[model samples]
Target: MTPDLEKELDDFKLSHYENADFDSLTKKTIQLYNKFERLKDKKKQNRVVLDLYTLYLQATEILFINSHALSVTVDRFPSALFIDSFNLRNFISENFAKTTELSSWFFKLIFSVLKDNSGTNEKYNLYTNLIKEVAKDYLGDYDLLNAYKHGYRVKANHSQTTLSISVGNGQHFKLNDSDSTITYFSKETRDGVPIVLQHTLNFKIGRIFGKCLFVCSLLNNMRAIILLHYKKPVSSKDISSFYINDKDEWNSMFGGSHFKQPVFSLKGLNKKNAIPK
Candidate 1:
């Protein structure tokens, strides 16, 4: 980004912070955290956790967009006004890349926990299958995020009548005249007329980030449950290992035993037979 654009974005974000509803955001986060803590069913737990993870991802996207701006020139206006580019370079490289890896790992581990702990395979299959269904879309997101991981740049340039962002080698994203629509040009086109692309923001980065945020929230909830139920560490590997090492011990200690004196059962006892014989 140009120096002017960067400055403008900083100012814009600062303003947003000043006006943002921290109180509401805080309350909502706490409410979800508490709900996650008390959940007993694995499916419900996973769903809540996903919601939290998606929230964080969405928040990160908002932060990145708020922090960056693009300068666009117009035919009639004397100066270019700044607009958000919603670029994925910073969000992906700095934070969401690691998040994507961890979310996948966490999801698999949580599924394993459900499958292992449950008595019936049908219930586990029901929940895990749901995740698999929703997860198909996230798989596509992983593909897009993989492209940005290996050091990509997003820069915007403008002539008097047109403005575009240079996304990659021979890949330019231009704003369509109709509001926030974007267009793409690529090597396959060979300098042909630009192809009208769908909204890259909502489809690509936004969708992925939203899914990550959902997963993150559920992961946090799972962490809380593990801490409470197992008294174990929050690290995924550690939690799994601790459960493995301690499961037998828990069963031995808590499983079943008979008292020397019967307190509740009255079998083989009658009024006359009550006397020791």
Candidate 2:
């Protein structure tokens, strides 16, 4: 690429990194939540909600990175940071991998706790199914995320508005009559081509963003329901234990101020009060 084109590409990529209005709120809300492990004040609880919403916004911001990656690849712009350009795609997929990993873990933790606490009644069963639907709808996304995380081959092949994903792992080989081994490359294929998706980039990215938002909404709804229905008060530790397995990991990523103690809780006091079924 020419120097002017390279500059333009850099400018384009940099644009993706621009801050949103809620970016400051995201940082502030997280800071406030971290400052108080168990927020008793109603105002603080509202801040916690904002923090959760901030997470959804951050996840959505990832789409800009996603869009930038595809644009870079399709344009075939070579960057000093990403000489192959394909690395950008891999990098974006890797982010998705991490998101899915954490989101899945969160959902599992919440559902497991709720399931264990509920009685074997139809109401509880229906609630469980509702949780299942969220997971079911995004099941493929979780699979793709896992594939990317494990170094299983995953790539997006795009031509204009049409995008197809190739997902597979490992290689196959055969020995010829001469005893020479031949290696084969596998792509997630449909009728001998990568799975063709009749969706535009906007659609695919929007779907991903929507799923992320749904998870955030789930977190909000689950907390509210547990507070309203469950007789026992749920502690922040109960919720944090499921997500924060490694202190070192959290400390390195978010600093000691964050995750030093449980930062989430139900919307009321510790007293046990029964909520209607």
lDDT of 1: 0.35
Model 2 lDDT on a 0 to 1 scale: 0.35
Off by over 4 Å in 2: 1-3, 14-26, 35-38, 43-47, 63-71, 74-277
Give the whole-model CA lDDT for all candidates, comma-separated.
Answer: 0.35, 0.35
Model 1 spans with C-alpha error above 4 angstroms: 1-15, 69-86, 90-277
The Cα error of candidate 1 at residue 209, in Å, is 15
Please provide, for model 2 over 1-277, each residue's C-alpha lDDT reduced to its tens digit, 9 standing for 90 to 100: 6888767865554443332232343344445445434656655543343333334344333332333343334245334324333453454344333344433433453455443453334433333333343333332232333333433233332112322334476543421111011111222334433332221111222222233443443444334333433354644423321122454633332200000122222334334752221
Q: How many steric overlaps does candidate 2 have?
A: 0
Could you give the C-alpha RMSD of every candidate to the true structure, in order shown?
A: 30.4, 25.9
